[model samples]
Target: MTTAERATELRRLHAAPELLQVVNVWDVVSATAVAALPGTRALATAGHSIAATFGYPDGEQIPLHLMLDMVGRIVRAVDVPVSADLDAGFGDAGETVRRAIGQGVAGANIEDQLKPLDEAVAAVSAAVAAADAEGVPFALNARTDAFVRGRDRSLDTNIADAIERGRAFLDAGATSVFVPGMFGEDVVARLVDGIGDRKVTLIGLPGVPAPARLQELGVARLSYGPTTQRVALGALQDLATSLYDGGVLPEGIRPLN
Candidate 1:
């Protein structure tokens, strides 16, 4: 599909009745491996994973060009739509997303990083406006770090902040508001009710509710962030340990790439 069509398809997936589950991938091999799965509908790039793969720390430490280069390669490697994690937009949300659209990325996650409400909303608007200028129905998963960044604050405060930021982001034209962090069913329900049904996205962490329960609670999407990459690396580490202990290669390993 063309980039625009992919963008539209991504939006449709978010609005679909079934909750969208996007496996986060960092490079061409990982992206292709996940995309080959029968149930995979789309892919979301994990900025932290990509940064770690490139020997850099997270939080836009990796050069924007390098991240986009990898993201573009992944886009070319798979037919499914890709939603890149363009961390905090690398300082210029609008231009960053504009460049990503040029890379054929259909969607992206831009974190507010707990910036001031007005500033965060402006960033969301800028990203959406940039996508509009490019004529792509880009899915902007506007993220608020209220829960992640506001750990010292009370849960009530964080939830209120998230709902406020989420509504503002939606008004500014974001496709969905990503509230990353673990939460109980009650918290999830409150967020969905406050932010509008099927308008909230979440990260699927170890203790998070199951996808079925999240779907029943009205989450639009669930994405596994750096955990997926960490799991893959953990397997490699175990294999290395086994090899050192004189273990032979495992049988029936299929070539995915």
Candidate 2:
């Protein structure tokens, strides 16, 4: 599909009755491996995983060019749509999203990082404007750090803050509002009710409700962040331990790449 077509497909996926489950990939190999799955319809890049691959920390620490370069390679490697985690937009949300569109990214996640409400809304608008200029539907997952960064505050306060920011973001042209921290069913329900059904995205952390349950709760999308990469590394570590313990390479290992 063309870049614009892919972006439109991503938006449609988000609006589908079945929740969109995007497996986070960091590079071409990982992207292709996941995209090869029968159920995979789209991909989301984990900025943290990409940064770690280059020995840098997350939060836009990886140089913008390097991040975009890797994301571009992943885009070229897979036929499915890709939604990149362009964390905090690398200090220039508009320009970063424009370049990501140029790389053929169908969507992106831009975190507010608890910035002032007005500034955060502006960032969302800027990103949307850039995508509009590029003529792509660009699923901009505007993220609010209220829950993640407001740990010291009361749950009610954080939820309220998230709902407020989420509404503002949606009004400013975000495709969905990503609330990243873990929460119970009640909290999720409140968010869905407050933010509008099927307009909230979530992360799939350990112990979170199953995707089916989350879909029932009206979530639009669910993405595994750096956990996917961490899980792969954990398997590698287990293999190394077995090898050191006199075990031969396991049989039936398929070359995904």
Candidate 3:
């Protein structure tokens, strides 16, 4: 399918009755793995994972061109729709989104942090408009960092702030609102209730219930972020340690046939 078609499909997946579970990938290998999964419907990139693979850090530390190249490679590798987590849009949200659309990204998660709320809204709106101009049904997942940045504030205040930003993002043409670092059943429920009809996206957190439980709590989507990469790296660390100690190789490691 064309990227436009893929974008349309991704939007439908998010708006569908069933929950949208995205396994964040960094490269073609990971993207191919996720695409081959039985239940996988689409793909997303974890900025931190992609950056780390290139020996950089997340938070826009990687160059935009390099990130776009990585995303383009993944898009070329997978048949399923792919979404990119373009952290702060590499200092130019609109331009970054234009490049992403050109690279065949069906959707993206753009975080609203390190910028004023109104400015962020305008940037997000520009992305939405750009997608429209290109005739791609792009799914714009606008993220707010209130929970992480405002933890010192009261819960009610944080919820209110989230709701405010979420509403603004939705109004600005974002397909979904992501409140990362917002976990717990009660907290998730509150976000769902407070956000009303708009789709609420939650980042996966340790000890949090599975997607089944999250769906039960009214979450529209769940993403693993960089946790999958961390797990894979951790396993590699254990393997190297065992090898250094002259211990038996791990079960999963085997010479190519």
Candidate 4:
């Protein structure tokens, strides 16, 4: 399928009856590994994982050019649709979103963590316009940091604010409303109910409800944001530790081919 076709498919997955489980990847190897899975419908990049793999910090600390290069490689390596966590659209929302579309990404997670509400809405609006110009139905997952940044405030306020931001983003043409740092079923359900029309996405945080439960709560999408990468890195650390402690590698560790 063409890039635009895949983009449309990705958008459909978000609104499908079943939950869209997205396993985030960092490089070509990881992308290929996940794409090899029989049930994998799409691929997504974890911003922190991509940054740390290149020895940089997350939160847009990685250079835009370098990030785009890596994402381009991943998109080329897989036939499945690829989405990237383009943190804050890498400074220029419209231009960077266009760059991602050029790389053939089906979707992206654009965060509004540090920017004001109006600016964030404008950014998402710009991304949708850019995608239209490119003739791709880019799945713009507009992420709100209300729950993460509003810990000091009351829970009710955080949930309310998230719904408000999500409504604004959806009105601005976002494909979905991504509310990270929200794990509770009640809050998740509330957000889903409040953010009408568009699909709702939640981060796959540890100890959160199972996929079935999340689906019951009306979450259309769930993504492991950096958790999979951190776990993989931990495994690498363990392998190195075992090698240092003993001369032999683990019994199950062997070449795939």
Candidate 5:
């Protein structure tokens, strides 16, 4: 497709009525699979996925240049719109959002993580402004870490904080509010309901529930967040072990790599 066509598709996707089952792809190969899926309307990349793939940790271990290069590869390998997890925006929010748009991503998941909630909001707001300045219809997934954080706050307190942070972030021009690490059904429902038709999303980790279950929970979108790479690596390890220890290929076996 032409550049204008691609941009139009990416911007129009957020308006989709059906819940988007966005998988976290780490490389060109997985991005290709996700792009080929009939149900896949967009692609999301994980920060931890880039860290693990590059033999680093998740705390911004992979630099922006490297991550942007990998993102470019995946974008080139797929036709769908891509939204990347730019963990903590890797710096201030404005530069983070601008750099991501510079790399051709349609959107980014900016979290109120590792810093005061106010700073996170400021950062995301700056990012949104930057993206807008560039004439890109940037979608910012405002993520709160009240539950995801290892703080000693009670669930009630954390929920309150998350809701408060969610409201502030949304007011700061966030395209959507994403409450990651809220895994419980009841908790998910509360967050989704709290956001209330403002295009909220949740991180639906694998083994949490069936996709139908998430859809039933009023979730507008779901992101896997790099579990697919771990799954694939484990499967590849087992396949190699079968070739080494089993001493024979199983029936109808073919190359996994």
Candidate 6:
């Protein structure tokens, strides 16, 4: 599909511009399960999900090759679009961008945690340039670490930093920027307000609001990083145990084919 058409399709299904919902699928089964859900239009890989399934935490543990293989399977399993959750982009800025584009992915989450801010900006910028050079519509959801560690950035300071990062990313041709782990309606309102008209798409998550709530705040995207992973586990656990424990199985529940 054309980039503009693809981008527009991504938007209309999402409804809030860059505001898209993502499910962390660790395997093909998970991908298939989520693809059946009607509210979702895209799939996002969780580095943590890959690492955890491989007996590691989310901290730069999973090999990029392994991650890419899983990403490939997710793409194969569903007809919808897929984005790689490349933690810290997995390399220097340029390589990060290059690898993602090389993978035939539509978008990625590149963070600034593992490097200094200036370096991170350069990397993100190069990645964006790479996307442009490839002539593909790639989305880069820039992840800032300043707010994650609770390093004392007030709402305004955080907003200012995000706007600066957002501007740089947009200039680099990034499709959008994701600010994770932030909450509170007022804070979200301020970020959208502060970035008025610059128009770099904004995404926040792990605590993104419901559709109605996010629409009211003017957020362009809402991604639920690992939330679905956690809940799905809870769901199957609840289901399997309910029958075993004689906990209110509904009518026609005993068809063991």
**Candidates ranked by TM-score:** 1, 2, 4, 3, 5, 6
Model 4: residues >4 Å from true position, as ranges?
Answer: 254-257
Tens digits of per-residue lDDT, candidate 2, 137-198, equal 99999999999999999999999999999999999999999999988888999999999889
Better of 2 and 3 by lDDT: 2
lDDT agreement with native, every candidate: 0.96, 0.95, 0.87, 0.88, 0.77, 0.66
Clash statistics: count for each candidate: 0, 0, 0, 0, 0, 4
- Residue 22 in model 2: shift from native, Å? 0.2
Q: Provide the TM-score for each candidate, comma-separated.
A: 0.99, 0.99, 0.95, 0.96, 0.90, 0.81
| Model 1 ranges with Cα > 4 A deviation | none
Q: For model 2, how many clashes? A: 0
Clashes of 1: 0
Q: TM-score winner between 3 and 6, please give it.
A: 3
Model 3: residues >4 Å from true position, as ranges? Answer: 251-257
Task: Order the candidate numbers by lDDT, best to worst.
Answer: 1, 2, 4, 3, 5, 6
RMSD value for candidate 5: 2.3
Clashing pairs in 5: none
* Model 1, C-alpha of 237: deviation from truth (Å): 0.2
Task: For model 1, name the residue pairs that clash.
Answer: none
